[model samples]
Target: MASPTTAPARDASREALTDSPPVDGARAPGRRARMPLRGHLRELRTRSLWVAVGLAVGALLGWALYDPLLALLTRPLHLAASTEHRDIALNFTALGAPLDIRLKVSLFLAVLVTCPWWLYQVWAFITPGLTARERRYAVGFLGAAVPLFLGGGALAWWVLPHAVNILASFAPEGTSQLVNAQDYLTFVMRLVLAFGVAFVAPVLLVALNLAGVVRHEPLARGWRWAVLAAFVFAAVMTPTPDALTMVLVAAPICALYFAALGVAVWHDRQVDVRV
Candidate 1:
C-alpha cells in the first residue's frame, strides 16, 4: 500500500534493523568467535604464573633440605664402601665444581619435589580445552602416573645401592674409590629419571588410544617388537653395563606395555559401542 520511494525507505530500515547487533550488550556474534583465543591466552598466562610459583616453592624447599638430601643421595656410595674398609671420596676437578654441583642439585631437587604441583597446574590449564570424556581420561592417567613414577623411583633407589656395590667391586682391590661428586650425582639422577619416565609409557599409549590415534589390535600384533624395543631401551638407559640392571629396567617397561595393550583394547571396545 506504500508509495515506491517510501517502500524502499521502509525496506532499508528493516534491513538495517536486522543487521544491527542485539541490544542486550552481550558479546557480539563476531566477538564470540574470538572468545576461544582470548580465553586460551588468559589460561596460558594463569598457568605460567602458577608454574612459576611452584618452581619458587620447590627451590626454597630444595635449599632447606639440601644437606639431608645430599646425604641420602650419597648413602649408596657409603654403603658400597663399607665392606672394603675404603671410603668413597668425592674429588672436585674444577675450582667451581662444588658450587656448580650444589646449584645443579638444588635445581634437580626442586623439579622432583614440585613435580606434583607442576603437573597439576598443567592439567588444570589444559582441562578446559578437553572434552568431558578426555578430562576423565586425563585424571585417570595422572592418578596412575604419579604412583607408577614414584614406584619406579623407589625401585631405582633400592637397586642403586646394589648397583653401586657391583660397580665398585670392579675397582682395584686395594685402592679407595675416589668418585667425583658431580659424576656420582649425575649417574644417580639419570637412573631415577630413566626409570620414572619408562613407567609412564603405558599412560602415553593409553592416551593415544583414547584419542583414537592407536588401537589395541596393532599393539597386540606388535607385542614381540614392543618387548624387544623395551629391552633395547633398558640396555641403553642402564648406567652400568650389567645384564641385571637391564633386566630390572626392562621388566617393568614390558609389564607397562602389556597393561597399555589392555587399556587400548578396552578403549577400542568403548569406541565401537559409541559408534
Candidate 2:
C-alpha cells in the first residue's frame, strides 16, 4: 500500500521516461545536431579517394589522346608562324623535356576532364551545412561556372593565333624564332586559366549577392569602372594593337557582368518581398 504522494511521483517518473527520446537519437538541448569531427574526417577521406580515382582515370585518357591534344594546342602557333611569315620552331631543349611536357599536359588535361566530378564532390562535402535555398543557388552557380570557364578557355584558344602573330611580328628581320616547348606551353596554360577565372568572376559576384555578402546597387553603380576594367583586361590579354580584338574579348565580359547585375537586382527584390 503506497502513499498517495508516492503513487503520483511514480506516475510522473514513468511519464517522463516514456516521453523522452532514446539516447542514440537524442540531440543536445537547444542546439542543432552536428556530426562529430571524426565523422567529418571520414567523409572527407572518402570523397578525396573518389576524386583521386577520377583524376587517375582521366589522366589515362589524356595520355592516350596526348598527340591529338598537343597538335590542337600548337595549331595556333603554326597559324601565327604562317600568317606572320616568320619561321618559328618549338623545341625541347632538355634531355627529358619531352617526357616532362607529356606528363604535365596529361595532368592538366586530367584536371580539366575530371573537373565536374571533383566539383560535385566539393559540393557534396559542403551541402549538409546549407539550407534548401542555398543549395539551389549553389547548384545553379556551379552549373554556370563550369560552362563559363570552358567558354572562356575556348575564347582564349580562338584568340591565341592573333596574340602569337602580334608578339612574333616584333622579332628582328632574318631571325628565326626558337621557342622552348615548355615555356610556350606554360604561357598558353596561364592565359587559358586567367581567362577562365575572369569569366567566372561575374558568377562569383552574383553568388555573393545571393548569399547576402553584397548588394545589387553597388555593382550597378560601378558599371562604368567595370566596363573600363574589362577593356583594359582584354587589351592586356589579347596583346593585339587593334581595338577590334580587344572589343571582342571585352564584350562578352561586359555582357556577363550586366547579366549578373540583373540577377542580383531580381534577387534583392524577392528578398524585399519576403521581408
Candidate 3:
C-alpha cells in the first residue's frame, strides 16, 4: 500500500543498516596502526624540543654561576693549601687548556642541573609501555634516589677535606706542593659519583626483589660475599688508599645492603600472608 517513492526510501534505509558493521563482535584498529611512524616521530620531536629548552636554560645558569661553582669545587684544595702553606696551581700544557676546562666545567654543570628534566623525559617516553605496577615502582625508586644521592654527596663533602689532608701529609716539608686544578676537580667528581651510585644500591636491590627477580634468602646468604665485594669496590674507587676513606665508603654500602635485606624480608612476609 506504500507509495513507490516511500518504498524506495525504506529499501535504501534497510540496505544502509545491513551494510553497516555490528558493534558487539567488532574489533577496533590498534593504536599503532591508527597512529603510524610519522605521528610517533612528531611526538618525539616535540618532547625533544622541551628537553633542549631545559638543557639550554641549565647551560645559561651554569655560565652565570661559573665563578662561584669554581670556588666551591676548589674548597678542598684551598683548605689543604692554607693548612700546609702550599699552592694548588692548574698547569696547562696546551694553549687553550684553561678555556677548555672552563667550557667543560660549564657543560658538566649544565648536565648536572638538567638531570631531573632529562630523567623525566626518558621516563615519559618509556612510561607508555609500562603497566600500573611498574609505574608505581618507578615512581618509588625515583623518590628514593634524590635523598640517597644527596646523602652520599653530603658525606663526601664532609669527609673530603680530611682525605685531602691525609694525602697532603705525604709530601715532604718545604717542597711547596702544588695540586693541578684539573686533576683535583677530576678526583672530586669521581669520588662524588662513586658515593652517589653506591648509596642507591639498596633501592636497586629492593626493586629487584619486588620484581621477583631476586629473593630474600639468597640475598641474606650472599651477605658475606656482598661485604667482600663492597670492600673491593671501596679499594678500587677510593681516590686514596687511606684506611679512613676506604672505611667511609665501605661502611655505607654495608649499611645499604642490610637495609635492602630488611626490605626484602618484609616483602617476603607480605607474600606469605597473601598466599
Quote each prediction's TM-score: 0.78, 0.86, 0.77
In candidate 3 the C-alpha lDDT for residue 250 amounts to: 88
Q: lDDT (CA) for every model shown?
A: 0.81, 0.88, 0.78
lDDT per residue for candidate 3 within 94-170, as digits (tens), equals 68877776776777777777878987987876565555567677899988886798788777777677778768867
Among residues 3 or more apart in sequence or in different chains, the pairs in candidate 2 whose N, CA or C atoms overlap within 3 Å are none
lDDT of 1 at 31: 32
Candidate 1 C-alpha lDDT tens digits along 140-167:
9889999998888887787788778777
Model 2, range 1-275, lDDT digits (tens) per residue?
Answer: 87889988999999888666545324332112267778888888999999999999999999999999999888877887887787887899999999999998998999999999999889878877666566677889989999999999999988888888888889987778888999999989998999999899999999899779999999999999999999999999899889999999999999999999999999999999999
Clashes of each: 0, 0, 0
Displacement of residue 25 (Cα, Å) in model 3 is: 25
**How much does candidate 1 score in TM-score?**
0.78
Error of 2 at 88 (Å): 0.6
Worst 10 residues of 1 by lDDT: 25-34
